[model samples]
Target: MPASALEGIDESTWVDVIQKMDEVYSQLIDDEIELEKKNAELEQSQQFIFSVLSAMSDVLLVCNERGVIEETNAALCELVGRTDAELHGTSLYELLADPLSVERARTVLGNTNPARRGEGLELNLFDAQRQSVPVDANCTPRVAASGRRVGTVFVARPTAEIKRAYHELRSAHEALKRAQQQLLHSEKMASLGRLVAGVAHELNNPISFVLGNVHALSRYSNRLRAYLAAVHAGEPAEQLQALRGKLRIDHILDDLPSLIEGTLEGAQRTADIVNSLKRFSAMDPEDRIPVDLNEVIKRAIHWIGKGAVPDFEMRWQPGPPLMVMGSAGQLQQVLMNLLQNAQDATAAHGKADKLVSIETEVVENCVRLHLRDNGPGIAPEHLSHVFDPFFTTKPVGKGTGLGLSISYGIVEHHGGVLSVCNQIDAGAEFLLELPLAH
Candidate 1:
């Protein structure tokens, strides 16, 4: 009620108005106390936030819309090596490393609209000694309880230690990679030594048998000539004939041809095996030349066929002799290993139309050789370890497990790649890639 309305009111009504005023006054005092309590809580909260900001390792800054520094934490003061009074009124740009970083900071801070947050710019701050200190800054607009934009709040942390750690981590990773490769190379050499020893042992048996047969044949030939001389000399034909009959000369003559042929074949086989071993073992690790990969593949197939014709139907699809820069012997070994594997896989399946296919092509200035077989594919669990040293699916004594591993190393030494995978429909496939020679 207005004071003008009170002038016309009766005394009793005025007294009632006075009582109501007293009640209103008491309520107002209670409201004032509650407001005071809330103000005190707000002040405590502000102090706590300021203390936390001061304690942080990262620099925190409060800037107004005009991009002037309003307040900063102890971190900022320590980084600048200045007192609070010296930094309080300075522009944020003045502390940045360069004009570009200054411009970026200004642009980010100028956007005071709460909807548009800063882009988290990275800047380097210059210390009192002019040393660079890298920092990443994330800025956002600060707003009051009345929903008005007050200023911008910046949070930044130094990234020098983080970057140093990253570089060290990268170096350690490279060292570990080199160590693993060295271990693999050592294992490959050991396996090759065993292979050589096994081959030598195998060759000794047939060679010894051949030598014995040759000595026996020489003695038998001498005996036959001497007996013929006795018949020609007037020594009694009947006696000589009787001796010949006793010696079974007729049977000897009949079987000699086969014996000679068998001996020749054994010798030839030993030679072939030796030749293949020579090709495999005569590799010069440092020698690289422009080689015809198609020729290498053909030679590998021929050598593999000479040992024993594979049970599988072998198909060779040779393209115009693709040239690549690599070690011929090592590449040939790689081809032989793959082809041998394909042959064994297809033979084991014992399926009709068992085919081992070798195909070559020139694609994208690289030669690609693909060997595939129609047989049981590699087991899924074993696929990942197929190229690992001493990993094999063959029964013990049937395989040494170093074939593929050595082949892989050989290919890598030649700056090529060897990879294997299960075919889409059936069997497994091996792919070899060699960069084209310039």
Candidate 2:
């Protein structure tokens, strides 16, 4: 009967039906292959996402609109001491440590405005031990493909870690400041050390003068004592007169005043030198006061000249006091550094007439001091870097290169300006300008 029924159907029709069936089967096979490829790609994408979530250090949680936990990363699971399966259906509010946090979370999750979504909202969450842990959290609305807000994604970082980072940064800043101060002090000491020879020579002159005056006074004292003893002995008037004449009492009397004056002058000079040295070597004070620039320059020159070569000369005219506002000690240091650098520059060139000439002028509201040296001027290329730390043309051991840099800083701190330029005539000239003290 099946064969009779097949005979009733045309062979061409059967052929057509077979062809249609084959086409349908082939289409099914192609569709199955396509589906398998898509599944492989989906698995790869899921694995990539999982790897990323596991690698993140911050807590991540995804919840539905009802606040039911739909997904969580490894960090959240480890923090709460729960597996993904155990936490899947749990309410987000149940993980909060306090009612306040729960209420805040509710407000944040309920917000519909994307721009007003939770940003840096601090919340306390229950940890593995049920202890509250503070975190800075950001919550963003997670929209589905249909453009509907389906849930909220929470990303948070522990506050303790942020606070620790801030503490470390502040500590580093303080340490850096201390190190800078130490470096400044060390450089000052080095500069002082370099002037030892000059300082000793400066003290020598006053000390030697004092010693000589003391010796003369000692001799005069002896003569006066002998003359007084003769008078007290009740010797005959003529004999006393003879002793007085022999002792040259009138001459001694004439010289005594001069000798005493000389001694006091020498002692005072010595005291001044010692005081200057003490001020120079001591740390600069923070207080600013009116300082006589002319006096400071004179002292710097006097000290630096004492140990310089005999031919080295500084030409400066005593003028009415140029008063400025600054730390006297710091100003002295700047002057000394300038003078020393000039002397070195001249000496290095072996100029026969090594001279440094300083001139001062009163500009509006400021006093400008120009120091010029008769030696090789600064090179065009090196002019800009003269005040840079550790930049020097001198031999490695000959200079520390911090003198000008420190001086520049000191001048700026004093509300002044220090600059240099190659003089057109012969050498480099440094100009220092300071505001006049009211």
lDDT of each: 0.80, 0.85
Q: Tens-digit lDDT track for model 1 on 306-364?
A: 88966777888777779988777777878888888888888788898899888888789
Q: Please, what is the TM-score per model? A: 0.47, 0.63
Candidate 1 pairs with clashing backbones: none
The top-ranked prediction according to TM-score is 2
**Model 2, TM vs. native:** 0.63
Q: What is the C-alpha RMSD of each candidate to the true structure, in Å?
A: 11.3, 9.2
Model 1, stretches more than 4 Å misplaced? 1-29, 51-58, 82-86, 106-115, 128-130, 139-151, 207-266, 275-438
**Residue lDDT tens for model 2, 1-438:** 588777878789989999999999999999999999999999999999999999899999999988999989999999989998999999999999999999988987787776535466788999999999998899988889998989889998888888999999999999999999999999988876756655566567767877988898889889999989988888899999998899899998998888888878778866765654444333444587889999999888887867755357889997998999888878888999899999888888897889899999999999999999988999999989898654678873366466787788889888889999988887989999999999
Q: Quote model 1's TM-score.
A: 0.47
lDDT of 1: 0.80
lDDT of 2: 0.85
Which residue runs of candidate 2 sit more than 4 Å off their true CA positions?
112-118, 178-201, 231-265, 271-424, 427-438
